[model samples]
Target: MQRHSLSVSELTEPDVVRRALDALCREVDGEAAVAKTALRKRSAFSEVLGAAVGKGYFAENPLARVKWQAPGVSEEVDPACVPNPTQVACLLTAVGRQRGRGPHLEAFFGCMYYAAMRPAEVIHLQISQCHLPKSGWGMFNLSGGVVTAGKEWTDDGAVHEVDSLKR
Candidate 1:
């Protein structure tokens, strides 16, 4: 719920509020299937709590006082999951061979390799955004890109939608 309209003076006591926050943390912990899941949720919850306190809905953020420790989990990206140079080349070759593939796809891969563009940015590219010179090699205008929330696609996730490349 939005915190702007909430009034701490009319709400429950500070101790009661603290206890409620504690209960919510416990509930989140219990429902979370993984430590990372719990950690992420708690992090966002803490932000909301902070906002509530800032709006004078509460004297202090109870979440600030509580110590949250997430259990250890592997944070490292798996080496096997990453594509080697040869694999990448083969994939690129395959993408190049697809029938009726537009120049955009080739340019997109070029951006991925040369400009180190993320996939979302490549997909959102427009033809008019590129700056191919009349004499020299072309250059891509990648001032915009898409980003997913929490490493997965969601309906409510934000995407950088650009109508035109910036001049």
Candidate 2:
């Protein structure tokens, strides 16, 4: 609004929204914004514009006609960075060798590696949730996990909050 000297009413045009998106693509660091950041910003803009239309501030959402495309993003993991069985065994052995908290952490790390459980899930795991047999495969009935959001964000003002698994 400040850059174009336009109010919310004037922003109901497709061209104006496109130009605003173009400006958003350029970052303060003189580099193009990442695809994820641009996508999230575009979603936020679309949501606000949609609300404005619902409130009769505009006849329609200008962003609906905008054709701005964010840059491509890759979500692939590098296999070389992942540890193999032998390396993981060595790391676990080292952890178990430590005196104080090491023994406790060794089992935690084992759960993360063997069951593919996240740290928060392992921290919140209960014995009843695990179905281990004398000499066979074991099962884990995962119910919830711990989230370490700041105390201010939680209802009880605790640093960690128990929440169901994310989608």
Candidate 3:
């Protein structure tokens, strides 16, 4: 295996850090994948750098010195990609008809459309966290979630066990 050594002092310059990140972006797969991976890498690197600076390893975080400019994102939603009311109705009807199947899927859609939830947030919901009454007009306490961690068949080693919603 090849070992790479990067000194903190070398990454202190804005230009140096920018160049390193640019190189990383080029090495990534596609444009979308590159952007996503680069952003995550940049965030993780910044966090580590911040901790190192606080521990007196460096006077300041080098990553903080650089001003990153993200590429322009399309603000307009694609018409073809956006589902119509009819399509949505069909999906909801199908989901409602899926008896004996996982109720999580149907409930997830309801939470998303009616309760305004993100798909990731819905997937993490537990039965214990919900409080839907018999009246079906009450709120649910979405606290935590369980995610698939490989093929373990258990709720062990899942990433990001959050205690609160992003809001």
TM-score of each: 0.42, 0.69, 0.51
Whole-model lDDT for model 2 versus the true structure? Answer: 0.86
lDDT per residue as tens, model 2, 70-132: 767556779899899999999999999999999889989999998999888898999999999
Better of 2 and 3 by TM-score: 2
Model 1 scores a C-alpha lDDT of 0.62
lDDT of 3 by residue, 55-128 (tens): 99889888766877644334567889967778876787788788776365666787787777777678777667
Q: Please list the residue runs of candidate 1 whose C-alpha ends up more than 4 Å from where it truly belongs after superposition.
A: 1-59, 64-75, 124-141, 146-160, 163-167
The regions of model 3 sitting more than 4 angstroms off are: 1-13, 23-27, 30-36, 43-65, 69-76, 102-104, 123-141, 150-167
lDDT of each: 0.62, 0.86, 0.69
Q: Which candidate tops TM-score? A: 2
Give the residue spans of candidate 2 off by over 4 A: 1-40, 51-57, 63-74
Q: Find the 10 residues in a row with the least total lDDT in model 2.
A: 66-75
| N/CA/C clash count, model 2 | 0
